[model samples]
Target: EVMKQPGTNVIEVADAVLAVLPDLQAQLPPSVHLVIKDDNSVNIRKAFGDIRVTMLVTLVLVVGVIYLFLHNASATLIPALALPFSILGAFTVMRVMHYSLNNLSMMALILSVGFVVDDAIVMLENTVRHMEAGESPLEATLNGSREIAFTIVTMTVSLAAVFIPILFMGGILGRLFREFAVTIVSTVLISGVVSITLTPMLCSRFLRVVHAKKGLAGFMDRSFDRLRSGYGRSLRLVLRHRLAMLAVFVGVLYATVKMFGIVPKGFIPNSDNDSLRVQLRAAQGTSYYEMVGYTQRIADLIKQNPDVDSQMANTGGGSGNQNTGRFAIQLTPRATRALTAQQIAQQLRGPLGRFPGFRAFVNVPAALQIGGFRGNSSFNLTVQSLNYDELYAWAPRLEQAIAELPEVEDVSNDMELKSPRVNLIVDRDGGRTWPPQKCQALEGRALRVA
Candidate 1:
């Protein structure tokens, strides 16, 4: 029976292997070992709960700051309430416009904090001013509303108008900034309405009667007196030699322009953080093990001084990545060391030069704000023309030119071209059957792509 079996296939391999390690063995010594595998999947519900807890804690902390800054709980509550109204309203607009709750949206929200408060601030300050000047709360509220009603309308309209044009912007830039503009415009519009309506109600109901303190008045009066005197002297000097001052100011302005030009015009400025990401890309088809090795080398270089508290690497590829390798590397803070993020990024880039295909991203936050892929630095070069041939020919030359630029990274033709292929020819008259068109079609189809 064993001779009838073909090679190992002819033999009962299961029986042969079982002879080495049998489960019901009366004939073998027991051997034990452990098998290992990786599974990163986890419970999603638990993750959502954790995120909620973190958000609650952060919100509570920020609310505490707001109260402290305003020095009044009611005042803080009134404005803080507006934050949600403004944010929610802004988010609603983004949703309607099919924008995501991404970095740009968050950035616009941060900016709105300062701006949304503007109308509210003016309303509250005006009411307070009227009250301080001896008017009743009712009178102060009505007069304040009347005073800035037109101003608020025009301002809100103007703000909204600014964003309306952005929706018409021609490229990805327009699409990216669209959310920023829309969010700001929407939140500002909502805040403006709240300022005119809700703010007046709160001013009347919540604001405490604050009389000018004698001590505070005396101190402010003295400070202003000195300021007035200084200003009066400066004004007199300028008036006395107006032409000389004008000439001097003009010369200074000219010098300032010259100085501005002297300062080298650089690309994006360094972004701040307690973290820096060093992205590594090796030649196509580099193995994960090789990438891990390179990452370790880069991490070791970073770990040398112990300033980096933590380091991790995640490897992946672009959408159409063939052989090109990619990595998302992170460096974190040390408990003992206090250093600016830009400084740390600079250090990482210095050592990363040893690994040729490495690019360091300092501002992870800013990259997101501009609506680009997270940590993606390379921008597209769009060369539109009536002729496709001219474009195809010029793209490589342009890519070469861009590659020569020290400031640019990942200089590419913005087009994908396949490697050349071999061809076999046959004459149909020599009793050969062939479809050259079909073969050519197959050739195009056979191009191996990622």
Candidate 2:
């Protein structure tokens, strides 16, 4: 029955609720029981925990790859140092922007791992190359930095520019990715600064004078030389057959465009949160007691499945419709349940369909709620008109048409007009002559109706 406000942490709110639960229970009557039928914070914590592990693994792999290529602990350490500085700078910028360590930002940081290291690698490689040519450590560091400083700046600016369009994007996607773009841009800028300022100093202090290669370093150098020679030959062959290469490029472009059209399109990818939502509506004017009975029957039906952990249902309120009932159903954890939430929802459709005068919709909550599009369904279509009669007539027809489409399912509409009612028409002018005593009984009934 509780919903968190937008832009607030679900975990923090859930924690606060847990902290006060004992007192709340003490204040409540013994007949009432409190339960957490659904907790989205569980999903949030698991998702972010995985992301944190990914970030750590990415950092280690990036550093490990640097060590493999450079073959020197000192050489590897310089660029490795850039990672934390750039990441810390990103964190500082995120704090300033009032951003949390949410999914989008974490994903951006993961991608920034590669970008931040690129600048440092470039500076370190150039400096190492100068040292291999017999320059002193200080001289190599200074000359190498001076030579590629402009290139580094240009590369950083160009990389940052790639995400500039995302900042100005509009709507839900824009809002979600704006933080992503800013994080990447800020991380890259900070990395470039670290490469220019910190990387060279570290190289000068840590890098020893070049000596003859003997072991793993020698083997890697030989392997790289062969790769470079092969690449050079391939490049020359492509340049010699420029027309053929152009044709290949055109073919690739055509295939890419074709595949783009063939692929299914969606604004957000589906995710499993180990929960489902059930919304049921009885015929309009159905009494609250009838709805409660229907809700209990449905709940009992769902609970018969061992996978269902708990459900919370309410009738006649919270949904803005007197005839509607809502159930926030929580399933057992994914590891414990044999079937996914979606699959269970599908299985229940047949049994739930047998209920007459009731429409039941089983849906998984959206992975991400954007703007006002937070319904259990994936898409929302709104129809507007100046005439209520026209709207009421067309809405159900449209719903039926959409439901018949092969690509669509679970289509529903909220146009209610069939509620039982009594219509009374009176002749106002003639009523002036009616005797007050004669109308007294009717007036009492009319008051009750009103």
| C-alpha TM-scores of all predictions | 0.52, 0.91
Clashing pairs in 1: 5-10, 6-10, 284-323, 284-324, 285-323
Compared with the true structure, what per-residue lDDT tens digits does model 1 show for residues 1-450?
123243343124534643554443544445744211111112122334545565466556656765554455666676666667777888788888877554566666666666676677677767777888888888988998799878877877787787788867867678668778888788889988887888889888887654543564456657768999999999999999999999999999999999999998744554443455555655655566776676677667766745555555555544424323333333343334676665665565555665665443332333223443433343555687888689778888987987899976544442544444456564658633556776676564654433
Please give the RMSD of candidate 1 to the true structure.
Answer: 14.1
What overall lDDT, based on C-alpha atoms, would model 2 receive against the true structure?
A: 0.88
| Per-residue lDDT of model 2, residues 71-172, tens digit only | 888888899999999999999999999999988899999999999989889998999889989898999999999998889999999999999999999988
Count of residue pairs whose backbone atoms collide, per candidate? 5, 0
Candidate 1's C-alpha runs over 4 A off are 1-81, 92-100, 214-423, 430-450
CA lDDT, candidate 2, residue 220: 93
The best candidate by TM-score is 2
Clashing pairs in 2: none
What C-alpha lDDT does candidate 1 achieve relative to the native structure?
0.62
